[model samples]
Target: MLIGEVARRSGVSTRMLRHYDALGLVRPTGRTVGGYREYSAEDVRRIFHVESLRSLGLSLKQIGRALEDPAFTPSALVGDLIRWTEDRLERERELLERLRAVDASAPSGWHDVLRIVELMQGLDSASAARRQQAVLARPEGVAVPAELLVRAVLAESDPNVAGALRWALVRSGGDVVAALAAGVRSEDAGVRRRAVRAIAAMSEAPGATAVLADVLGDPDPTVRGHAALTLGRRGVTGAVPALVGMVVEGAHDVDAAEVLGTLSRDHGCADRVLTALAGELAAPNADSATRIRLTQALVELPGTTAREALRRLAHDEDRAVALVASAFVTVLDERCREDRV
Candidate 1:
């Protein structure tokens, strides 16, 4: 076949075929009387081979090495190609994700597109400070999509950046509750913890409460504990068990106690709160340290029930427990007397 016919059949352009011939990658087997280049069957097949390798992202020089080098091993070259293809695929996927985030933002113009792109890039920057600035310095008109914020929040390991991202999500405030709900279900313990923490930071009324309520049963104690603490502060009585459990486990037990105290102020749950604390204190396996922590937790609860529980605990068999409870009772009595006077 001639160069034109070869180009037509093999989809390799004539110019490229000539270039290949110049490079000795594929040379014509013969020439006609007019001195035009003519390719034999083997030459045409070699052309096809070059085109095939090019399709696999082989550079012309690499293709020359692959086709002409007598000792070139394909295994190393193929491995390199695989790695390069994988890298390209990863880059494409990331680009597609960025485009989708930009689309989700619903940018109105080029400026909006650029702004969103810059913000997304900043969020993905290597510096935690840059990521934080991306969140904190976001301009008023360009809204970072809540999905992006959710992703950042879930992956952010830095406490300051995570807090800023949560703040941004709260201000962005469109269907973020749903986005965060997915985070609460993540199998990664860190992601679930961040999700629940972000969800807790959101207002209780805008479906965050319901999602958090569902997350109360999350297998991760950190996730469940944060959710419960938030819910308790929001006056959701459903968090009582988890809150009481935190007191028992000494996991953020102080804050849990404070929130429980606030919940008990509702008057209806005061007895229940006091009872849960007293029960934890009275459990058979309750060690002296557990008793001491529970004794401390009691100071948060109000009403006569809590006072009476503290009074009984004040005389407990454990000397340390008695000392702590008695001291709390003394403080309570002084506060009561001051209130009356």
Candidate 2:
């Protein structure tokens, strides 16, 4: 076939075929009387081979090596091409994500679009400080997309940056409770913790109370404890048992005691709190240390139930328990006396 017929049949342009000849990539194997370039079957096959390699992102020089060099191993070159393709694919995915975030923000102008892009980039930044500044520096009135905020809050590892992202999520509010709840269910303990922290930080995280109520049942004690404490503070009586457990385990017992005290202020839940505490206190296997922590937690409870429990504990067999309970009974007596006057 002549160059024209070869170009027509192979779909390689005439100019490109000539360029290939110049580079000695696919030289014509024949010539006509008019001295025009002619291609034999083997040459045509080589032309198709070059085009096939080019489709895999091989540069012309690389293709030349691949086609002509006997020593050129395709394994290494193909692996490099795979890496390059992956890098390009990742970049495109990131760009698509940014476009989605920007579109979700509903930017009214180029300025808004740029601002949201900058904020999203900052949220994903490697430096914790940059991430924090990204959240804090959001223009006052612009609503940063909630999905971006949710992602940042879930992935943020730095305490300060996480706090700022959570604050931004709360302030930017647009139905983030579902995303946060998903975080609470994450298999990664750190992610679950961050999710709960973000949810608890919201003044009114929609569905947060319900999600946290479920989190109260988490098998991880730390997760359950944090969720219970937050729920207790919110006056959810279901947290009383977990709070009492915290006191028994001596994990964040002080904070748990304080929140339980706050919950006990509601007369409806006070009995439940006192009963849970008394059960832990009276358990036969309850160690002396657990009893001591329980006694401390009782100081936060109101009504005669705790005071009466203290009075019974005052004469207990354990001297340390007697000493602590006796001291508390005296303090309660003094406070009652002062109230009477």
- For each candidate, the alpha-carbon lDDT, in order, equals 0.88, 0.89
Candidate 2, after superposition: displacement of residue 7 in Å? 4.1
Cα error, candidate 1, residue 226 (Å)? 1.9
Q: Write the per-residue lDDT of candidate 1 for residues 221-317, one digit (tens) a residue.
A: 8888998989888789999999988888889989998999999997368888887887888899999988898899888887777888889988999
Cα-based TM-score, every candidate: 0.83, 0.82
Cα error, residue 236 of model 2, in Å, equals 1.7
Put down candidate 2 lDDT per residue, 1-341, tens digits, no spaces: 99999999999999999999999999999899999998999999999999999999999999999887899999999999999999999999988988889999999999999999889878888999999998898778897889888988898899999989888887875899897888898999989989888888872566888888998778888888888988888888888888888999899999999989989886378888888888888899999999999998889888888899999999999989989999999999999999999
Off by over 4 Å in 1: 69-71, 127-130, 282-285, 333-341
Q: Give residue 252's error in model 2 in angstroms.
A: 2.4
Error of 2 at 241 (Å): 3.5
Candidate 2 has an lDDT of: 0.89
In the predicted model 1, the residue pairs found to clash are: none
